[model samples]
Target: MSDREKLEARLVWERPEPASRPAPEPLSREQIVRAAIALADADGLAAVSLRKVGASLDAGPMRLYGYLSSKEELLELMVDAVYGEMASEGPLTGDWRRALSAMAQRTRRAAKRHAWFIDLLGGRPHLGPHVLAHVEATFAALSGAPGFEHIDSVMLAVGTVDAYVLGALRNEASKLERGMNQAEWEAVSGPYIQRMISTGRFPMLAQVVRDATHPSADVVFERGLDCVLDGIAARLGR
Candidate 1:
């Protein structure tokens, strides 16, 4: 299909099931998506394909097209599946700040559980039912808050929070994917960094490297989240 045609194609969720009787083997969209997700989880998004997913289900790749029009549809289904996983963490509570903080934390935890999740994030707008529900819940968190009186304000606030959360998750996932955990990074580059700092050419860098008490990832994430919320509150005059 042409690009425009592909873009206008109906989503898997919107498409009607095959008009014919069910396949003798009883394959379903959920089964296809679940198998695709398993492949992604075990390896990465690159490892998931219509052929592989079909093989996992003991069917041919053509069988999957009966349910999903294209691989893009499968990806959309997979992304929505992960959103369903995120929603299972339960609803947000407390005031706007607390609600948003909880949302970010929950999202971070979800990304940690599914590293491939970060790969799909930010690529396209997901409008699946579960995705819409999560968006609705997020909007509900700021619905009647003081600074979110306008829809624009609510959109801005949510977008800002999403930006921070996605960036943080992507960074962490990238590090893990490269097999360079914090300890590995330090072990590999520590000597070179220390030598550069000892040259006294960059005082601020030297001071930060020498004096900063690097907190645990959890602590750092919480502090950064709080800082983002603080900025939002102050900027919005809440």
Candidate 2:
């Protein structure tokens, strides 16, 4: 099979049910996915494996193959499940800025809820139904914007906003995964940084350390999102 066909094959939604019989009872695709997500939520993604998931389900690992062919397929389902969570939180607004901003913030919140989400992101396209719906909703919102008459403009707008969200969320998730909060980070590295600034060789760094107002993560995220949205508005002549 071609690459796209292989991907499609892995999508349980796309496959038709066998006319003769249903999947065996007491074990299901949904159960497997739910178990895997729970395992991932408690432990990191590394803790999730077919064996562990099967164990959680009180089934042998081989039984899981009836639903999921491989770990990669399970991951696709897990990521798509998170997208479903994002959609459930709220609907996108008619205004482009409102829609995009909401999406970025909502996605960040999702990452916070599912810390392993960042690890599954990137390196491949998410072709699941929920993700495709998100892409469609985003395109619809952007298309209604003033300067987004052309498809290319809409695509660019989506890409720009998505890039910012992914970068910011990844940064935040990485820190959390390291078991360090902002205060903890500062406590560990602050002494070395202050010592460096004391030499007077890094005046700008010292000035920032001395004068910059350290805001909460949420505030900083909002400020950065506003900057991105402002640039997009300027480009779109809104």
Candidate 3:
């Protein structure tokens, strides 16, 4: 089986039955949200249409309108739900660097697990309760870090990590498509690497890849975090 096949076998976004459970009481908004979450958790986010969510809930798409105003609203809710899973209260124990690193790692892991999430997340950034909760947790994690005086600095720090994680995933997803594992990325890109070298057309670009250690998602993310932290520490005189 191909890697995609294995991924399909493993991550289920849609429930097996794809129908909502019968409830003893009238379906509350909470029930609707829960059903949507289950549907997304079982199936990839791409499959979580309003109709699909309602079908999973054993209701028609129109029924979902009674609660959520539109499909966009529902998607936002789902994003928020995913955010709810992030670590809420563990960021500020003692070591600030450790805390920041922990938060970055956890976010990276979360992105990898919910692989389709980052695709839709940025498209809608109004931020539901759950998304806010996760951001709050992230801020809390960086609370005592240097240069967090204004909310802008904090937002910038969080955005930097978020961008780093998302960028890393883009590379990973591309590799997954091309069957280019770590070793393969280096081997396959070798020609592309060499072409620039011999051309001498772009010396700087050529040299970078010539000695260039082909970067991995982890390495890129860690380097980005280190740079950001270094800048923050510098500004704060830490």
Q: Which candidate has the top score in lDDT?
A: 1
What TM-score does structure 2 among the candidates reach?
0.90
After TM-score superposition, the amount by which residue 43's alpha carbon in candidate 3 deviates from its true location, in angstroms, is 6.3
lDDT of 1 by residue, 86-143 (tens): 8998898899998899889888887877778878889669988889999999999898
Estimate, for each residue in 107-194, the C-alpha lDDT of model 2 and write its tens digit.
8988888889877877778988999998888888878567888989888877888888888888777778668788899999999999
Off by over 4 Å in 3: 1-44, 88-91, 141-153, 174-196
Instruction: Give me candidate 1's TM-score against the actual structure.
Output: 0.91
* lDDT tens digits, residue span 166-201, model 3: 676675666665755767777878888787678778
RMSD to native for every prediction?
A: 2.6, 2.6, 10.7
Candidate with the larger TM-score of 1 and 2: 1
Better structure of 2 and 3 per TM-score: 2
Q: How many clashes in each structure?
A: 0, 0, 10
lDDT of 2 at 110: 85
Two-way lDDT contest, 1 vs 2, winner: 1
